[model samples]
Structure formats: structure tokens, C-alpha cells
Target: PIPNSYWATPLLLACEYPWTPANPNKPKLDAVLHAGVRTFIDLTENGELRPYNGEVLATRAEFLGIDRQAIEYHRFPIHDRSLPESIEFMYSLMEVLRDNERRGRITAVHCRGGIGRTGMVIGCWLVESGRARNGEEALAIIAQKWKTVAKCNKYPHSPETGAQAEFVLHFE
Candidate 1:
């Protein structure tokens, strides 16, 4: 696999919530709850990660006293980067994130390193937030913020899939 240029988003903050990293250097936990984050959304991939355990995230939420009711975790596989089904899974994940945001919930979203998958989710959020006019512009904004660019599928498995990915990301 080719190395990506960008680091993922550590935490995407909305007006309703103030987000802070678990640790300033490497934010393992999405967003700390006591610091005004009403909802904690863990968007990381699972199934084989030993250190970033899903149970730990749940435990942190329980410890934070953040009502645990507001948290959501949806796992979408990140391997096989060129798969259309994977791309669709990302979209479905976006729908879940967008719904909470629409309800005025402040969400702290994160994945490993806060880059690739994290960046894509953040890009979708920006689009949904109207902070970004389009997907192209959103990508540029994200690249600028993180000092790294997202990859365009150079080996897109199918023309239709490539076109589908391109179509949704119009503003950036």
C-alpha cells in the first residue's frame, strides 16, 4: 500500500461541543466528555486492533458520566481501499454522524491517527455543515488544515465506482 500524505482528524468540533484529545500528543480517545462534549462518536475500524480496543472507548464513556446515551460507534472496514462497498459504507457512516449533528449534538469523531478514514468522515461533516461549498473545496480545506492531501483513487477498480466517489465529492 502507498503511504498517504495526510494525518487523520483527531477531533472535529462543532459549536455545541468543545472537544479535547485524550492526550495532546496522540489522542487515543475521540473527545473527552467532561469538557463539554455531549456525544462521543468513535469512527475507528475494529476486528483486529488490540490497543485501540472498542471496550476501552465504552469504559471511558462510562467513567466520564456523559450519559453514555449520546455515544455511537459504527465500524466500517478500511481495507481494500478501492472497493465500492467500502465507499458506500463510509457514506452510511456519514449519515449516522450527520444525524447527530443535525440534532445539535456536539460530536467528537476520531479514527486511528485521525487521518485517512477520519479525514474522509470530517470531509463529509464539513459538507453537511455547509462550511465547505463542495467536495473538492472540502478536500482542499482538509488538506490545508492537516498539511496532507487525501488520495484520489489511482487504481479505482471500476469506472462506475470511481465516478461515484468523484460525484459525491464535488465541492472539494
Candidate 2:
């Protein structure tokens, strides 16, 4: 896991991109490998990729003398601080989670800071997976879980925007 990473479930981890913010934190390829992450989900689009050191895909180790084949990388990006536009995208994301769970694989999902976009996806997954009753419930759960792990804010904004929250609330 990266610095602020935490598990939303035993199998689903919420974490920052390995090379996020591109500063002293650096790429935590070794940490991701050591943490036993198997399914890596990226929720950031290409424009969001510009600020980071580079995109961190499971297939690309971004490190020398290290094998990253064990991790399965996936990209189902949406706009920054936004919800996925298509129902099909949500279906695909959930399908990946289901498939990975069936394989006994632990998955990690990330956007740049692992907050807004990451939280939106996790919240939607929570509702869809029946772990949460509704969007409000899911956001509350996220706030608790995220704060416990990251300590980034006294009042962390999981779905940073109202529309993002609404999408989760009305998520099918």
C-alpha cells in the first residue's frame, strides 16, 4: 500500500496512485508489490496523468529488476471529482470486482489523491455490492473508513462534489 492506503474491505483497498503527486513520496512499487495488491484500478483520465511522475500500471513496474506481472491492471477512468458517466462503466467495474473476489484476489483502487474519485467508486461499489443501503450510508461509511486510514482531514470529503454524491445516491 501507499502512504495513506487503507482497505475498504478485506479485498478492496483504497489507495493513492503509486507515483502520485510526483514529489518526495516517489513511486511505491515495492510497497504495492509487498502489500499483495493483485487488481489495480485506475480512475483518472489522461489529463490527470500529466501532473504525476507517470501512470502506475500493474504491467509497468516503473522499477528496475522487479517483476510486476502478478498484478492485474485496469483503467475505468472518469473525470476528476466526477462520477462515471455510463451505467456500463459501473457494470464493468463491479464485474471486475466480482471476478477478482471469486479468484481470491485482493484489489486496490486509486485516483490521484485516492480521495474524491476513489471514494466515489468505492461508495458506488459499496451500494451496488449490498454493503451499503444507500448513497448517504455509503458516504458515511467512506468518511469513517477513509479518515481512519488517511488522517488527511478532520472532515474528509469523499465525494468531493454534490453531483458525485448524487450519482452514488442514485446509482443503479
Candidate 3:
């Protein structure tokens, strides 16, 4: 798990799909509810949701006591770098996060593995928020945070590709 100190707002969490069988120990809906994460930002395409242990995104959010509307799905293709449209999506995500934070709610952002696409967005946020000077620095902070979390859970997490890295650098 990511230490609270790694975040500007401790409520912002980067994660993978929690219902998959591959991660038996992953947090369940109840755990997410307890953690106060009311908003879920999904970066994967809609088509990918079916393979996630057969649980649909809207249904999972309902199970967690969250309204289906609170679960925002921004269909960013996996492995590929962000395009011009992706920047627009990032801006929109910022608005969602800001709104949620104002309401005293936490937000969780995830892709399939929650490494590449998730990390890219988080890194963009870090830089845009002035938590880091640039995308490279933002990504370095994310990598370090992932390393710390990985040491405890043994889950491999980091920005997974150079394309993602470059996208973050040019995201502004």
C-alpha cells in the first residue's frame, strides 16, 4: 500500500482493479467504502471491464454504496501514449478530483494494472499541481512511492513504458 506521505492530498490513491482473482488480497468493496474513496476514475476502455473477474464497473460501484455516476470511466487505451484528446481528459479528471476533494471525499484512479495509464495521469496531476517541477520529476516521485509500496506487498508497480513517460513529459 502507498504511504499517506507520498501524496499531496492523502486521499488521492492510484490502484489497479481490485476485484480481479489475480490479486486475491486486493481490497474489496467494503474496504474501499471504509477508506472513504467515493470516486473511482477508470482509465481503461469500456470493453476491458468484462474481463475483470466478470464484475461490471457500475455494479461494483453500487456494491460499494457509491452511485454509478461517481465512477468516471475515461477510456484511455492501454500501452499507447496519450494523445491531444487525452490532455483534455486529464483536465476533466482534475475537475472531478477537485470537486470530490471539496466534498471531503477521496478518489481512486485505476487502469487495468494501474501502472502505466494510472501513473501517467497521476504524474500529470503532480506536475500540474506544482508538487513536482516536471513530468520526469513527477514520475520519479511516483516510482519511489511505488517502490515503497511494492516492498511491503511485493506487487510490481511503476510507469510501465517509455511512451507513457514521454506523454507525461509533454502533457502540459
Q: Model 1, stretches more than 4 Å misplaced?
A: 1-31, 38-43, 51-55, 80-87, 147-172
User: What C-alpha lDDT, on a 0 to 100 scale, does residue 123 get in candidate 1?
Assistant: 67
The TM-score of candidate 2 is 0.81
lDDT by residue for model 3 (1-172), tens = 3332124358787876545545544455446544666666767766765444224656666776777676544444444334326567678777777777677767777776666777787888788767889988887788777765433255454566777778778766
Instruction: Kindly list the per-residue Cα lDDT of model 1 for residues 1-172, writing each as its tens digit.
Output: 0123232232343211112335543232433444444544444335424343355555566776655665655455553222325656666767776676577655555444344445556666677667778877666676565532233344221111334336448522
Worst 10 residues of 3 by lDDT: 1-10
Look at candidate 2 and tell me the lDDT of residue 41. 86
**How does each model score on lDDT?**
0.47, 0.75, 0.63
Off by over 4 Å in 3: 1-8, 21-27, 51-84, 151-157
Number of clashing residue pairs, candidate 3: 0
TM-score of each: 0.57, 0.81, 0.70
Best by TM-score: 2
Please give the lDDT score at residue 146 for candidate 3.
76
* Candidate 3 collision pairs: none
